[model samples]
Target chain A: MNKGVAVTGIGVISAIGNNTGENYRSLISGKHGISSPEILETIHKNLPVGEIKISNESLAEDLKLPKNHSFTRAALLGAFAVKEAVTQSSLKIDNETGFISGTSVGGMDTTETYFKDFTQGKTENSRYVRAQHPGFTTEKIAEHFGITGFVSTISTACSSGANAIMLGARMIKAGKLKRVIVGGTDCLTKFTLNGFNSLMILSDEQCKPFDENRNGLNLGEGAAYLVLEAEEELKGKPVLGIISGYGNANDAFHQTASSENGEGAFLAMQKALKIAGISSESIDYINTHGTATRNNDSAETEALKRIFSKNLPDVSSTKSFTGHTLAAAGALEAVYSLLSLQNEQVFPNLNFSYPMKTSGFMPVTKLKEKPINYVLSNSFGFGGNCTSLIFSKNGG
Target chain B: MEVKIYINGIGSISAQSGDLFSGDSARIYQENIFQAISPNYREFIKPMALRRMSKATKMGITSAKIALKEAETEVPDAIITGTGEGCKKDTEKFLENLLDQNEKLLTPTSFIQSTHNTIGGQIALNLSCKNYNVTYTQNSVSLETALLDAQMQFDEDPEIYSILVGGVDEISEKITSFRKLDGQLKSKSIKNLDLLKEDSTGTITSEGAHFFALSKEKKQNTYAEFQTLFIKNTIQPENINEEIEAFLKQNNLDSEVIDVVILGNNGDNRYDHYYKNLQQNLLKNTMQLTYKHLVGDFDTASGYAIYLAANILKSGKIPSVLKLNDIDSKTPKNILIYNQYLGRDHSLILLSAV
Candidate 1:
């Protein structure tokens, strides 16, 4: 039962890149994707975001969807990413194959745009009426691949992607599924832009995750997915990495703010390590949930200190490059974690000059090549949802 | 090492009151859209905290508390919730204000509470249970997804004994009305009790929250045994009989052994045939029951069916209002529930008397 779930392939489309190869290139090259909104029609032009430059029309056209299609931005991005993963893995879509997607806003972009028109009695875009549900986005991607089994969507805010991956792994482990496409997708929308803006956490510049001088986070839009298959299903397929363990916990502290002690993060990480049947010392790299917000960074640092008291693993926040892609953050980071393990290198945490004074823990500021075996990725979100996943190089 | 899971307790806040399950006459609503009969939230939650919550959050928390209290469990090992259009009232409010104010001068209160996981997170906060918590938002199968996760949790961890799981969905001003524009709701005004009687294109819409406290160890208050459940994204109408047969066969049970079959027939003529096909063929001889007629249709409307199934198994009483056929059972042993919405997200759940 402890046999690891094999990650056969990974796909991602973030602000920095449109595919896994491009994302890896941007990550190691120290290129950040944070920029002022270009395609997203948000009034917060001053706010920086990891906005994908591709427009919805082009994405639909590229996907070969009809003009009357109800593909929302999130659905479009999700399909765009899933197609690559399915192709890379050479996985056959069948009744046994399942699809689980994590999304926060889901199709909110389409809803926010067409809401007024619908209320004013417009029916031209009524196809998007049910698009607000996160499952709609997932089903769109599922429909594209003709997958008709065990489709579900998780919406635990920012940690959604990690939770989705975790659920997929658990399902495979439980023998409920043999192969499943699992990940998360979200796109920039006026609703989320203004919502985060209302929280007063929108950083006007590139996000500086875990940096002492970090002001806030830059919201990003993207989608990422991993093809997880059981050992029996992988006859000759190349394994990207192995999802050895995963854990989910709630802070139960506050609705929005994390606990000061990072209790949830600590428990989640500890649980992941226990599930992976390894000690904390075995982890070679840590992909932090470091959203660069004051509360999150400090709490996560505290959690890290508790877990790795003496020798902290080479830690970095890839969100610095992708600018906290919300629901897609964990899947994007999962792909990055696989990249780190495959290349035997750790991606740098961009824009980190100094650590917080309270917790003077400095993150890896430059790309470092090393013998990486185990990678632990953290993803925490609103509603105090915290998830941690352990990826093993040797299938554990 | 398989552990038996039992439904220790159930709490529901739906269109009809609790008395309906106790053989009271059903409340008739002549409208296509209805809301849950809210309980006194002050009894379950502090009034100060209740003021800021949306109906979905209030119902979820209160119902969860009810289930936990009934189970005599202080804190569960995990909490999982499935919701469709979570906190839509708050989401709509935040979106409308954001648009109305033209991205100017907006508060974060509504936005903060609008998240899909707010109910699960809030239940955790209220209980101070820092254990595993998650939320699923998969349309009609949301509750089934949570149940599937809980089932997996039991298989993975021996430490997890009790889990609080639920399905919730609420209506909003702009968002719920959008269903009418999209033909997801009946165009004509229909009575709630007459939901299944009318030949309609869309089912009546409503909001509800149902919570179940599941435990590995059965207690005196245990309702029934949660045998198993299956969820599939899509299936052909013609293949449903075979699907049910396959599921039953997988569990070492067949139609003859089934006592009561709870169907999710919401009166949408286009989709009702799926249930009609099953009713005439596979489950024709079985005692048929339905609950969406009593509680208006929503994504998690099947939660009511589960709640009803548990209660029926425990008390051995088949509420007359839910009977789809005159087939009677003095003490039903097995209950199988099959539900779907708009011809997608089909689910099958099996429960048996303890």
Candidate 2:
């Protein structure tokens, strides 16, 4: 059986920064991207969000597409990220390259805009009729890169992107595809803005992860992708990091809330550590999915306590910087984790003032330079979907 | 390297009524376009939790519970699901509120439940099973994709004892209207039993949830063994026979050895030709049967066909209502299911009686 999958290339677009370099620079500099919504036309303007400064029109222009193209903001961001990853990998688009993308909102941006118009007998924008479907968005990305083999989309809420990467690794291990590009993308929309506001989870101030004053998560928009290749395909390509282990588990607790004990997160971390064939102490850092919400931080803290009895590694939530990018959170954090491994540095959980009274866990408050070997990234989404991914400096 | 994955238990909540394991006899709607089967979810879910769940979540959880109960397993190794338009009811609710409220004071319950993975996540939460979770949303091939993932898990990890896999799809008024506007749904309603006979332009749309407990270890209740599955984004009508032959060959089986063939023949005249081609050339002499007529057509409707094939293999009895032709067989063993939507997302599933 294959030992490990090589991560050859990476791409990202988040509130902290657009490209990988900008994101990394912002991470160590402790720059927070959370702000009031300016681009998204939502009544929840006071609510904090990691809104991208660029407009959809400008994103399309950057991609050099026709003016009347039906590319949704989600598609535009996804294509941009995938283009970077593919270019960096130096891989040709052919039948051998597999495209696996994850998204929760798909084309909801376009669908929400045209929902009423379409019903009013307006036939002007029928091109987006199928955009609401998740598969349509994935197909757009696949077609953009001229990829024709084994394309699929996963829609597991926030954990979608991490699951996509896990599936790509399994496919490579199965010898199904020689090269695979896996990641996730999502764009801010009034649909999600109002959705989170309705749930009363949108924080009014900058999110304070793992802090006693934490309120809730701040929604964000962006896309991130990674190109993973089989061992033989690696040849002389510089490997960024090795995807050594991954796991998924369901809490089956509630539709929108996590359980008190963080059962799903605990199981997912346990399974991932088992798959990586390493002890908990081997993990030097953890990029938490800490959305700074009451339910998520507590549950995740409990999960960590259960998984690593006494020796929990340095943990921090980068969502403090980029906000919670829904489907792209896992991928964005993955890129950050690889960066941490390469630079042997840990990004601080900005805006944290005090530790939570219940969990009594404190995240890395300031940027710390340390020799890091393995990093565990966690992402949990609605419907109790929890996923954990472990990246190692060397092939496990 | 070759490991056998068996369907130990099956559960479904579709237009046709009945709990998991009970044949589709308690309630079967005769209308072409029927609503989903409503279950007393209180038994499986709490009232507070039930209040927030959409039709997709309720159906998925109830069916998953039934499947797990039948298999007598408390926790599964993984939870996987597939849906085309997931949580449509919530999607519509949230969208309506978004436009009506003009993006003000909208609650997150509907929006949170509206994601495609909500059902899978809910099932995982309900079972407290945290092994490996994934969801697929590949149009008509959604369910097949979930099945393929389960099969891969079984082949790769022998420790994975049981995996809960299912597909769900629901219809909402706005999306349904849009589909009708797009000429996707049938224009005129016909009897559900007579869907195939109607030479219409579109197929009847419906919703359902089908869950199966798949494992590497076979038991007495094991329904059938999943052999292989293949999905193609686009396939020409002329290439249908060649594709089937090649797939069967890869599995070391030939067309003549197939005992039964389940076809997805929704009343859509444009795309029904794909099934007709297979019926006429590839498996013309094989025992042909169909189920979309019984339980309208949807993205994951082929899941119903898999349920029926599994039961048929287990009982060795063919229901008269599902028979498409009179090529009778004393004992049906190897079964192949072919399904596609709008001439795209073609999928082939092979199963054998355990």
The fraction of reference interface contacts (C-alpha pairs within 8 A across chains A and B) present in each candidate is 0.84, 0.69
Tens digits of per-residue lDDT for model 1, B39-150: 9999998888999999999999999999999999999999999998898999999999998999999999999999999999999999999999999999999999999999
Worst 10 residues of 2 chain A by lDDT: A1-10
- Evaluate every candidate with DockQ and list the scores: 0.88, 0.59
Error of 2 at B18 (Å): 8.0
Best by lDDT: 1
lDDT of 2 by residue, B164-205 (tens): 899998878777667665667776767777788888797777
Give Cα-based local distance difference scores for all models: 0.92, 0.86
Q: For candidate 1, write residues A66-129 as lDDT tens digits.
A: 9898888999999999989999999888988999999999999999999999999898899999
What part of the reference interface contacts, as a 0 to 1 fraction, does candidate 1 reproduce?
A: 0.84
Off by over 4 Å in 2: A64-68, A358-360, B18-32, B39-52, B191-194, B197-200, B236-238, B320-328
